[model samples]
Target: MHTPSHDWITTPLTAALLRGALDVERTAHGLLPHRLPARARAQFHDPQLAMAESQPSGVRLAFRTRATAIELDTLPTKRVYAGVPPRPDGVYDLVVDGRPAGSGSVAGGNTLTIDMTVGGAELTPGPVGTLRFAGLPDAEKDVEIWLPHDETTELVALRTDAPVEPAPDPGRPVWLHHGSSISHGSFAATPTTTWPALAASRGGVELINLGFGGSALLDPFTARALRDTPADLISVKIGINLVNADVMRLRAFTPAVHGFLDTIREGHPTAPLLVVSPLLCPIHEDTPGPSAPDFSRIAEGELRFKATGDPAERAAGKLTLTVIRDELARIVEQRRADDPHLHHLDGLALYGEQDAAELPLPDGLHPDAATHRRIGERFAALAFGEAGAFAQRN
Candidate 1:
């Protein structure tokens, strides 16, 4: 439906330029991103899994080129959660030679409508949209186009004025991280602006993110997917989704964590692994959940959430942020004796009460972009600083 100007060379979209995604599905019009490889994706049809994996949370297109102009055609599935303002179009970030160069947004694409009250959803497909960038330095340089973190983006065509080739690896350690919706980038400004992405940037490592929005429930298949991926460093942010989802009790949670870690160790036995507990979510602090949506302000286009479970339920093995944090700390400590590479990072260390007083969770659940930045900076210092867990030995 469009015409190319002046001898634009189109290169096949291959793994060389794409990072963070586990697999790509060849579609009639383009390629769909998948956090879970095809084998794992085929193991489950959970809608949460489908949405999370396809969102392309940390996926980006990177290459070395001399082109002053570039264009990318993609089909983005934008989500509109009921009772809230329509989410804005996803932003694609342009980074040149490690510096942010420019940004572009795709206007029209697919739309996925979600009704939290009834827990129903439907997708309406739209046409492919184009993202264009120009005014480059016209010198051989590394370029990256970070895809939208929240929207499901299917990359279609890539056109540039000059020849493009795979960017040379900088020989940086690859950091693989997994967590819940927060890590999946609920309110991050852009794909590369996610907390993990920020941390990875500060840490100076390649990133492979498996942060599945509501689907980071410590599933075995996800563990296997992480196990198979190559990583020099690993971190797993646990507890929030488990507590919020109200999926398992203490009995089930303990064994599940053990099994998840056990599976990951199978492939990355000696890799430095950090176990992260949930951040301070006020609603689920002492209270357990199945967090209920607050409809009182929904009419005003404000979406708020409140804990629905009882505080006293903790005595009955009901999970809460406090309970999960304590358990995760204890689990990591006990395991560290046998697994020297294992470490524990309390979520509070990333976003504790004092910080919350200043940068409160806007929705009473997810952190705003500012908090994400703080967490990322703190994490970078904690895990990648000289005395940090992932610090360079030399």
Candidate 2:
């Protein structure tokens, strides 16, 4: 519909430079084997119950010919993952003609769209939905797009003429993170860029996200999970879950955290471990979690929920962050002489004082993506910054 500029066609040298070290490919649904050979079966191995229980999922193939000039014509499947509770969404990082031109996120229910920008969501195609990338260095190159899960989603035919290339070495550093739902990315936008993921990207570390939503109790299983995962830097965001779940009293909470650390130290004796308390949450900050269902809510259509723990049991200072954090500090202080590697970082650093004053929880619960970004930025500056002990060579 518009006239092309005389300089629309890029120079061949430009194309060659953009297509440096070409390697690309496409599969119906699976990890990019060529790029992630080491983690070829990672998605399959984890097999989250949430993903397994979903219905009608599939993937598609798309390629592009020109380095810069590209368009998204159509997609494979769209009517998928309909029943799943939390919908999947993220920007697809695109490898155009063997080089990283940009990526896009999928959008719309039936039709699909592609954005030529980093962290951009997929767009749906209309009569004018066909996207065109100008100023393309004229060259024949393979293009490949990657997604996490293959099955249980709508992925129609991929659009591209370029050949698939190998995965780009992300060169991520190592970050070990632990926490409850908030840390587990309960309300974050996507999987890769959760607060931990965002922090890792900023800090340049590989992330072992041990942020299990509603699962990070002071349980031995959790310590075992931490003990097992490989980590260069470690962090445990504790408190909120235990407080809300009302799982223990002060006495039990104290020893449980110590015991948890004891078990983790058995494996990562020297790894720098940061113990982060819960961020500022109102519902459970000071109020004792109800041990019995608030039947009044159910009667009023509020969907009453059963109490997770006994309130009377926690009345004896048996369950509280103040107590937990104090005990943690004491434990670390006591062991610092023998275990110089252990470290403690308060959660407030990430979302304390000024942050809580400015940015409050939306649902009286978890922080939104903006808060996640704020926390990630601060964490990168504090826990993983150049001055961070984790940055020190052990």
TM-score of each predicted structure versus truth: 0.98, 0.60
Model 1 stretches with alpha carbons more than 4 Å out: none
Error of 1 at 66 (Å): 0.7
Question: Which segments of candidate 2 are over 4 A away from where they belong?
Answer: 1-172, 290-315
Best by TM-score: 1
Over the full model, what C-alpha lDDT does candidate 1 score relative to the true structure?
A: 0.90
- Residues 270-362, candidate 1: write the lDDT tens digits: 999999999988889999988878888888999988899999988999999999999999999999999999988888989999998999988
Q: Write down the worst ten-residue block by lDDT for model 1.
A: 385-394
* lDDT tens per residue, model 2, 131-213: 34445566755554333222123232222234323334344556667677677655465444457766765776656555655
User: Residue 128 deviation, candidate 1, in Å?
Assistant: 0.7
